[model samples]
Target: MKLLLYITLPTILFAFYSCKKGEVAEVKQYSKLKVTVTNQYKQPVSGFTISLKTGSRSISKVSESDIYTASYEAGGYTLTINKTGFIDFTEKIQLNADELKEMQIVLKAGEAYLKLNSDSILRLPSSSLSSIVKIQSNTKWITKDTSDWIEISKAEAFGDDEFYVQTKANLSDSIRSSTIKILAGDHEQQVVITQYPPIRIKKTIGIPGNVMTQTPSSIKIEFNQPVILNNLQSLYYYCISGTPLQPVVDSNILSFNYSCGELGGEYPFSISVKNTIGDTFAETINVGFYLQQLHFKGNIVTHFVNDKDNSFWLLMENPDILYKIDMRSLKIIKEYPLFTNARMITVNPYNDKIYIGYSGVAALYILNPDFTYKTIPIKLDSTRLKYNQYEELTPELYPVNLVFTKSGIGLLSLSYNGDVGNSRFWFIDAAHGHKTWYTNAEEMEWYPYTMDVNYDQSKIIFTNYSLQYFTVFDSKTMAFNKVYSKNTWNQGDITVASRKDANVYFQQVYYQSVVNIETGSNTNATLDALDAARFDFDYGQKNKIVGFRSWNGYVEVLDFTNSQTPIAYHYYRFFNSITNTLDGKYIITAAENGNGDSWVSQFPGEWFREEATQSSGNTLLKIKQYPSLIRKSQWR
Candidate 1:
């Protein structure tokens, strides 16, 4: 009995000791764990809130920095870390008591969207119908909440899947960069935003002759605000009127002087606009002009001349005569007569002959090619043959915008015909003496800003300043082909670069645009803050439109090679001089009269210049250039 009792007591004691040791070991074996979160760049990520759960039991710890320390009972667990605009990170953590554990996590920044090919909606020329780029495809521009985007593009391609495009761009101002899993639809070819280029724009009045031939000069670009040239390499520029390469000059200003040397014509230039930001606009001016020796008299003599001297042709309104005068000698070297009465005059390609039209006649004269005889009237009237007794028709009138063709054989005229109680174009065939083609309209669809014929007469483009429409027609048929219209185009001049490809530049008051017409699906740029007008683009200077000039009494030239903005070129304040001529270098602004009135600046004796310097005395025709002498030898 004593032996049995001793054995049982030893067994019980051993069992109690084993149970106490097991509890002690459990308390010492489990440990707390510390973790740190970071980005792929190794930058510490902060404000990572982590939520932990075990069989419906849950706890949360949000860290000020990326590091966190938490105690865990011996168990298997799941952890989730979250931040704004960042992907939530999840990890499986195994823990124990009495020991330290370490873990590292990484979160990535995010991206936003894909670049849409807006050409489908905007320009989308007829040729791109095969690409199958549909509308509303790239309109998704936002990212998922709490997740950062690293790129916006195709991520996976499995067996025979079409080539998919990918975007790897990030935004710092709105969100962080992110790397995401992506898949593309089955498209055989992929298109991506390989480059984002800024837009280039220009606008100007196309040379008058360019309309007949469909050739233009550099497009003088005018913007509503300053042009934002964000990317230099992304821009592709072309002049619509002036020289093509010259559209972008040494200055940032766009200039196109296409063909100034063409004889017997007048030309103007302007710009069109585009950009990667989906910016697009056109010039406000339909026609731009460069006034030379603009005599304030109603019978003004504005002539197109070579810069070297004043040797050029003059448009005389009094008798409706076009004269080729020698700048060196004030002699009427040659005279070209016209019909009705003259109001405005212009030449083709800066040629030897001239063109004159009457203010109330539907006639445009094609002068003799040799400068000896006057151009005969080929399209004659039938002497008010048939008419309604109740309807009285007035004579046709010609606007003051025109140009000559290179051959000097054709004269392009933009005549205002109210005889039919409507506005229409009268294409006079000089060779056949008949109306060749016409675009008739009952209302004034477009008030002519300027008229231009290209050097080849293949394209005909015009701007109706009041209508804000750019009408491109077939030069041969006078048939409408295309219309460049939308909001943001100001009423101004029109011009073309006369190129076959997208190298077309045009502008208005709103912006400038440059593009290859061959791939002309979208505008190349959009700039802002500029005022361009008809009195800006002068294409006779080799089709290159030097920038706009202001009429501040002095000459205001702009150098636009440095930027989309313009810089002052030359300024000359004129002293009121009556005896001094305003044109031919030595313009005869001074005419004797005053208490003696001969029309110019009321003066007496031989003739004197007007003196604005001395206001209180006799109104003497005074000038500061010649001091007190008559500028007799300076007419040219």
Candidate 2:
């Protein structure tokens, strides 16, 4: 009995020791990990989810806590902490057996932010005394003013805030700027403010009391202060009864002069001055005068010059009288009675003879330089006439427009019953009287309202009135080349460029388009709509095109050399008729005086020369002296 009791006790003791050894080995393989989440302010962040992962298995069951405690096996493990407003924190950790690791995690506050409604502000010289600014920030922010001129109403604010920025009336002629710096915690933002000097037109001096036949030498305007001359082109605009002039700035003074040939009337003028920040001051002035009369009567249809006597011939329509006046003295030189229905006149560039077309009779009156006149009969192709079969009446074709080639061949556009579609175009040999080539009436719906020839005379463009298309003909062979159907409306006038393979069409309703003769494509040519009533090409110069805006009484001069925009524009009285000299040195406009009488005036082409000088990098003063030279020379 004593031997059995000793063996059983030893077995129980060995079993107890083995169980204790297994428990110690198991505890050594695991580590205790604690994770704590806090904000940037070091405050406790609750409701944060904690995850402890090993391989593909989740070792932690606790999802949310400010402090998460977990036991993980030794070696590499992943620990993740997540919160609503804070960025997620994830990290890999090496677990040490039986070691307690406390990890402090910092969460950034997403609600703390600073922003400004606008980064910058512009204050005009004439602006009101104060400006309002809006601020967007969730945290408390402080404002600091960097300049004496700018005053902020609010220095400290929380959440979105409104601030009043105050500035004194800018008295100086210079621009000023300031900044307001906003600080929200560590975030810094800025608001910029700018102020411009006040713009003022003090007074005008040297205004002409009486503008006779000659233009005033100089008209000067003084400003309250000197201003920057950038974009000076839009600074001032003036309108005359007959001509237009551009203003020149010298320091604070604005001065301009006109030539002697412009008609006498109340010359209405306006001046607007602006500062760098678009503050404007404007004034209007009117100067009136009277001039001696030339004793002319009736509406003038055309104005031509007799090179022999250096006189201008005014062709009157109602009285059918041609009055010759000396250009220098503006005195009547002679008066010649013309055909009762004389309509159009042109000088033959090939020969110095003048050809006048009469609508009443199918004939052209040829006037020699010696003032001797002769008549040439125009025979119409009877087959092309649309006549009534029952009546013996032959429809007489009236001459409406005329064009001459470089070879002195005259192409006359004649209409029957004032219908353009059924009209005929006849080319006459200027050296003789007979017609050379007449467009076939059956195959051609072309009614030539206006005609233009290319520089090399390779193409002749005929603008149709009734038809939707204009005809392009081979100038040498007089054969049909191509029909430009892009111009849907037939009312627009056509002008072909002498230098480039392009033609400009001015639509009466709206817009002007350029057609590429080579590609047969159209593109916009003008920035604004133009009046089709009167337009002229600078033929000799081949660089500029002038169009009259009758509705607004403004003349737009387009320089093809500068493709972006019109080079020059001037305001004038509404003119019914406009024609430029062959040399393009002068522009003549005629308008009825609302009475029975009509007035004719001349404008020097040098008005646009200022823009040309600016493009060439020359001073405006250099071309100011050209008005007198342009007035003295006879352009036609």
Candidate 3:
């Protein structure tokens, strides 16, 4: 029965068997994945390899044709495509058994090369325009400006285009520069831009050429462009002769309101003006002054021979050297060395001979006009020397203060060995070279530091240091007429000036008092707080007294007719001595340099008085003028 059934096979079975035998078919557990690669421009990409990966297993031997085919198992697979000049493509794919899947991939081209129209750029700081930078590239580009002053109108753009780079106005004096970077994918280009500094023009200063009747109120300067106010101080200078003046600046105008001094002459000055950017402009100008200057090699203690030619004999201390200076040429014609420990020098008005009193010896050195000299010993009366302790009866006469009368009589305040028993005031006949009388018999321990003769040479006003007393002596008889004790008048290092009214004005320390020489009555004068150690007084007409604070470099003018408050007070540097011409038309101040040299400055008395009157009520003027005066008076 089984044989008969097998022989009679079904037609469907026979057809299935014949089809399987002729095709040799096998069941597949994988799928075919087709990957097609194209560029961003939609063009086919060749020479690319496609990798099929699953877990840690991968098949990367599949090369790219028109389409890339890879047999992947029925699971999740990762497809990685790589090619030159294109961005690699990667994707995850899912395949079913015996299923055919196609994947379309687009590749991005590599970074495009970027080109700039110019690699370097230059512009002026005054330029207000923006610069346009053109880029030649196919890829999208971006720009970055590193500086805040530098601006980019278009920071990023697609493809090649023109970008704007702008800059603000550069107000600075220095040059400024910046760099801009243009980036396109991996390619980059840089543009360097530099801006030059602004231009500055020279300015002109207008100065008055005429003689200044008063202090200049203002000085104007014209400029082509606006300038910085702070920079003006460093750019301009004002000088009289060679002395510098500190001027206040208000915009382009400079002002000076203090007294310019009484010197009368042509004052040549130079101005070196510069801009904020260091551009310099020079100008030389001359202005007339009412005063003159005479330089000396040493500190001038006394001067004689006031003439039109300005020739004078000067007595200097600290080595005892004498000099004859010719003011016209400002030269020292002659100098003489006096080998003596002298404290005071005086010129005999009758014979014009020089007399120097010694502090170490009881002698006087007489110097002639031809430089010849002789020493005369001072003789003390042994009968009157009762308090003298020396064994020789002739003690060392230390003459500290000396004053000569018009009749060639010398009043010397002397001390013997600085002892209390031998201090005296002596009278000597300067013309005869002999000591006539002395106060040794009347007073003991009287150390006189200063002595002054009255205008008529009738009275001598003497002040003592150790024993505080002011004594008045009869010039003819050498007798003590009156004595002011320390309890009544506590003054030291006194200076005396006789007025035309027979009134004596005296200053000791900071106290000023007026005494009636006829009656010996004193009235205290108003005085400012003076802290100086040395002071000098010059009494002019109209009850005006000019006081010089030597150590502090201050000049104070007091009008006795007015209140005690100083009418004019000014401060200067290196001011040591003060003097006035005999005619009282000018006031001269002596300033010492660091080199031990000195300069004489003359100022108009009338101008100074007028300025003081004008500035009396203006507190602002006082405050402003004081500092400027001090600054200008400093040595260069």
Candidate 4:
């Protein structure tokens, strides 16, 4: 009994020691997790799969209704909720002992949309056929009302589909129109339907002829088929006589006569004529202008001459239109309509691509050969916003001039309406996917009246006339080099850098002077002529500068290389803008009268020579005037 007790006592003590060293097994504590899913409107959502994962352990469950509940061991876990037709909801969760965690999740609905190919549909008066309209939609859509004269193939559709609209032949000669409404939930849009009359004007004569004399001229209107004339009413009769003579109708032909007042003036006439069948035709005609210039339906806004293509491009308003004219043929080669108003333009010398700038937007438009264009919005540094003279920042900066370097980089100048001293420059590298930079906002002050590039294309120079600030940019590096503040005596409204030297020419308010850029000194005394020249250009002839004596009817030629003397040659009319060809063969100027009449004239370069003082140059061609005297020579 003693030996047995000794052996059992050691075994019992060893077992107790092992148990104490092992430590008590940890008690597993769980936490309750509750998740509620809802939509954007706070409505409960169902049929969502919820998953919770921690290390190697994971729990997944499908919610039959809005709420999901589960229990998990205390730890950090990843939570995710997914459903079809809804955005996924994901989060990280922490569970604690004996704790209930509740989560409110909002699931966003998938995108819903509806679209049509066009906003309007036009049909003929004689056809009962249907017109198919393509549509793109992700939600169910339906027509609002049943049309009487129109019948649709389907009243409702889902997803991407098409519908047909059929209309009966119109019995009346008058035109008719209707509006159709398409509805998709909270989205609604309209489509306009119009049917025109069968009758249309076939031709007209003497409609746009000039009233060379005060006498009236006979006008005739011809139609497709025989028609009876009912009445004629004048809409706009500017510079025209009382009323047009009563028209004499013979079959489909109607004749009338109209008289006008002065010469060298434009006559605008508009008339509306009705036939016996209630059909009407309305048209506005420019009876004509005294000067035989190219006529257009839109007003000329700006123009650019492309020497490489031997073409001239014009930007016109009243519905923006771009017209390309062949300089060799003097006829329009092509025309394109624009969706936005573009006031400034330039050509990229490297790619021959066109860059257009707008008036009120911080954007540039790249025009392609196929008449398609892409817009690039410039992100303006709002911190550098320039308030106007009135200290108001409401008006945004717009591009006033756009010039490109030989390397395809575009330099744009921007300013506001008034001379508010808020002007800056933008350097854009379009070839490199539109990489852009800007001038030091603090470095720019007052208005940048003019900008020019040197012959080597290495330097770009511009001036701020108000502050007498002259700035130079390194074109090759696309960086600002320096800016010089000139004295008020040498302050000028226009400045041009010499093509061959470091000399810069300034056409002041009353005189012209030359400044040496390297020495920062005025090299020449002021040459005072009759009236300050409003426009000038580098003559491309051995440092020769030509200035147009505004309202003096003369072109002043000065030789900076020699004694700075101004030689004047008679030019019949005052010039608003002027430029010359690279070979110095031709001089072109666009002029306008106070009466709003404008014309463009070209003169041979030889006519402006010092020996040609008695030579009164003749005009080669005439066109509408251009704007902005500061940018008078963008012909290159």
Most accurate candidate by lDDT: 4
Task: Give residue 488's error in model 2 in angstroms.
Answer: 6.9
The candidate with the higher lDDT, 3 or 4, is: 4
Query: Which residue pairs of candidate 4 clash?
Result: 421-446
CA RMSD per model (angstroms): 28.2, 24.1, 28.2, 26.3
Model 2: per-residue Cα lDDT at residue 337: 80
Q: After the best TM-score superposition of candidate 2, give how far the Cα of residue 110 lies from its true spot, in angstroms.
A: 99
| TM-score of each model, in listed order | 0.33, 0.44, 0.49, 0.44
Off by over 4 Å in 4: 1-300, 305-307, 310-313, 323-334, 388-397, 415-422, 439-441, 478-488, 497-503, 515-525, 529-534, 537-553, 559-573, 594-597, 610-636
What alpha-carbon RMSD in Å does predicted model 1 have with respect to the real structure? 28.2
TM-score of the candidate numbered 3?
Answer: 0.49
**lDDT for each residue of candidate 3 in 1-636, tens digit (9 for 90 to 100):** 987778777755776786654586665588888877788788888888777788899887646474777677788886667667765565667898888998888878874567986545655444555888888876567788879788898967766688787788776655678888887645788888776545433332222221122233223444333334332222223333223445555543443322333232233345455444444455554443423556556655655443333455667766577776654444577888876455566655545567776556777778876777787776665655534555655554666556666676666666666442356666777667455565445543365555666656556676765444567766466567555522354555564545234566555554556566776666654453343334434434554543433333334454444433333333333455455544446666556656666666565555345443433432211112322222233342
Mind giving the per-residue lDDT tens digits that candidate 2 earns over 138-222? 6567889867777789987877997888887778765678878887645788777777667665554332211111334345566
Better of 1 and 3 by TM-score: 3
Native-vs-model 3 lDDT? Answer: 0.56
lDDT of each: 0.38, 0.57, 0.56, 0.60
Q: lDDT per residue, candidate 1, 1-636, as tens digits?
A: 999999999899887887755475444356688888898898999888887767788788789977898777767786767677665555557776577888888776652223323331222211112222222221122212123322333233222222222323321212122222222221122232222222333333322112111233233443322343322210212212223334453333444544331211123323455443344534333332221222222233444443223444555444444555544355556666544456656554434435555555554555666544354442433332122344655323443445433333232444334222233344544344434333344222333444544425454455555544455545354355444533345643444433123233444555444323345433422333234322232221222222232222222222222222222111122222211122212322221112221122111111011111113222211112211212222111
Superpose all Cα atoms of candidate 3 onto the true structure and report the RMSD in Å to 1 decimal.
28.2
CA shift of 359, model 4, Å? 2.3
- Backbone clashes under 3 angstroms, per model: 185, 0, 11, 1
- lDDT comparing candidate 2 with the true structure: 0.57
